[model samples]
Target: MECSDARMLLVVLMIVVAGSRQASCNVVQFIFGDSLSDVGNNMYLTRSLARPSLPWYGIDFGNGLPNGRFSNGRTVADIIGDKIGLPRPLAFLDPSLNEDIILESGVNYASGGGGILNETGGLFLQRFSLYKQIELFRGTQELIRNKIGAEATDKFFQQSFYIVALGSNDFINNYLLPVYRDSWKYSDDGFNEYLMMTLEQQLKLLHGLGARRLIVFGLGPMGCIPLQRVLTSSGDCQEKTNNLAINFNKAAEKLLQDLSGNLPNTSFRFGDAYDMVNDVISNPDKYGFDNSDSPCCTIGRIRPSLTCIPVSRLCKDRSKYVFWDEYHPSDRANELIADEIIRKLGLSQLNTTNSFSQSTAPSPAPFS
Candidate 1:
């Protein structure tokens, strides 16, 4: 071939290779929510009680050093990052990390004790609510635009994955507080509806801010957590709390369905965490867990009032316990949940156009 022809062929090959590499690059993930998906944002807060930067919290995590993750190791966000072939995004509040690098990769805006409503975690006095988290995300968006220009930043978000795992704290920290008497004011169904409506508005706000691919995790089986179990006389699951979570999940599913129909070019997946964790609690043996009702770390009576302090008794084998502390799941259980999430919404599956439609039903199989 002539030298000019050979040069043209080489240019074509380079363009094809570059395009392929861009297509194969892992999708950037921006996480938002409460403690379930919180990496370490609570650690940055001064007066937050919902912190995990202490001994035994990250015992299973490498180096046995707590980086503010509530579990005995990684959270679902960390596991999902690994599964999706991306490094776990740095917490947006971590001062040690470079802001530019974090924005380029992704950022975790989740905070422990956070909730959908601004007043939800007010009892804690220092939690970043979902509304505030989104406000922070808006700052990140500005930084992204500064770094890559507005057009490129818009495109970046279009190709990114957004995971939101919140609302559980609304019940755990706010409505259920004896001092609040939220139930008396709003009844059970009324409260759940209120939460769903607020969540729908926040999700729509996120979509407006450039998120296209989104995964909204439903409230888990809060009644079966160690904290709730301790509240019961027999230490059994609180059926009322469980029912509330189920109702919320059902409403959340419908919300996603509605959002998909209303929003243009948006793909929403509702992660049924209530069903996922409930299965593990119901059949611990099936998931290689020895204890599902009690937490691995406890002090007084395995209750919400007694958190995993520095002197708290730690479990010998953390993997066998479904919960690490009173409120959070063990790292093993997190792994299971994350794996299930990936299986249901893998990168290959996410690439399809069918995911954009409301007609596409989520996978119904429970986590193994």
Candidate 2:
């Protein structure tokens, strides 16, 4: 062979290898939500009322200590990430969160008091709203671009998965509080429209930022939570509050369907946490639990404050309780919910034993 021909072929082979290297994308999870998925971002906020730092918070987590999760152990996000064999994304506000960590496993921007709307958790004094979390993510994107260049960064987000579980606070904290103007400003359906409108915009922004594979978790039966139940004179689930949740969930389901159809190269799925948890709470015996109306770690005397403080009452067996606190699911309950979410993400039939394969991710076709 001629010397010029040999040199030209060698150069072409090197270019091909470089191009492939830049295009490679490893699947990871970018989580966003409130307390249900909070891995302790609120801890950094000095005055955040919703920080879960008590001893009972993480008794079931690894090493039996607080790892920033609001529940007794892992949150739904943690369980799903583990089931998929993905690394746990560090809390966005964590001191250890850096460029290397962002590249290794994305970030969890979930704050305990966070919500879909910026004004949702205003009474909390400090929390990252959905918009704020997205803003932080944009900063992370810049850092990633500086480290790996824009092309590779774009591919990274395109291939990665996103889990956004929020909006409950918009009702439970803001509108229901009566302290916020949202309560008096809008009626039930009006509030629903307001939330859906804000959420649609946030989701579109995320897609524009390169997110393609994503799931938005619907609210659970918020009224059935111990906090709301304790508020009632009858100690029963507030059916009115539950109805509000149902309506919002329906709107979210339709919004996702439309977004999926309209948005190009996007697979938007709705994780029906409302129906899933309602089934468990309605029939605790089916899930090896005796009581679904109470929280295991709360000061369970049926008061408004259902927090699991250091001096609060404790249940005999945490496993038998579905709720870890007034507002969050127990570790075991989270496990069940995570499995449900996995199924919703088009992973029900696949062999999860192999760890989820991003390459095979499917669109959010209506579940059978």
Question: Residue by residue across 187-258, what tens digits does model 1's lDDT show?
Answer: 888999899889999999999999998988877788888888888789899988888888988999899989
Deviation from native of the Cα of residue 332 in model 1, angstroms: 0.4
lDDT of each candidate versus the true structure = 0.78, 0.83
Sliding window of 10 residues with minimal summed lDDT for model 2 = 359-368
Best by TM-score: 2
Report the lDDT tens digits of candidate 2 across residue range 1-368: 99999999999999998766555444767998998889989878999888888877777765566778888778887777776767678999899888877876789999988899999888788999999999998998998899779888988888888989998899999989988999999999999999999999999999999889888888888889998888888988999899999999899999999999999998899888678789899999998988899887766464556357767776878788898788888888888888887886655321223333342221211112
Error of 1 at 73 (Å): 0.9
**TM-score for predicted model 2 compared with the true structure:** 0.88
Model 2 score (lDDT): 0.83
Candidate 1 has which clashing residue pairs, if any?
A: none
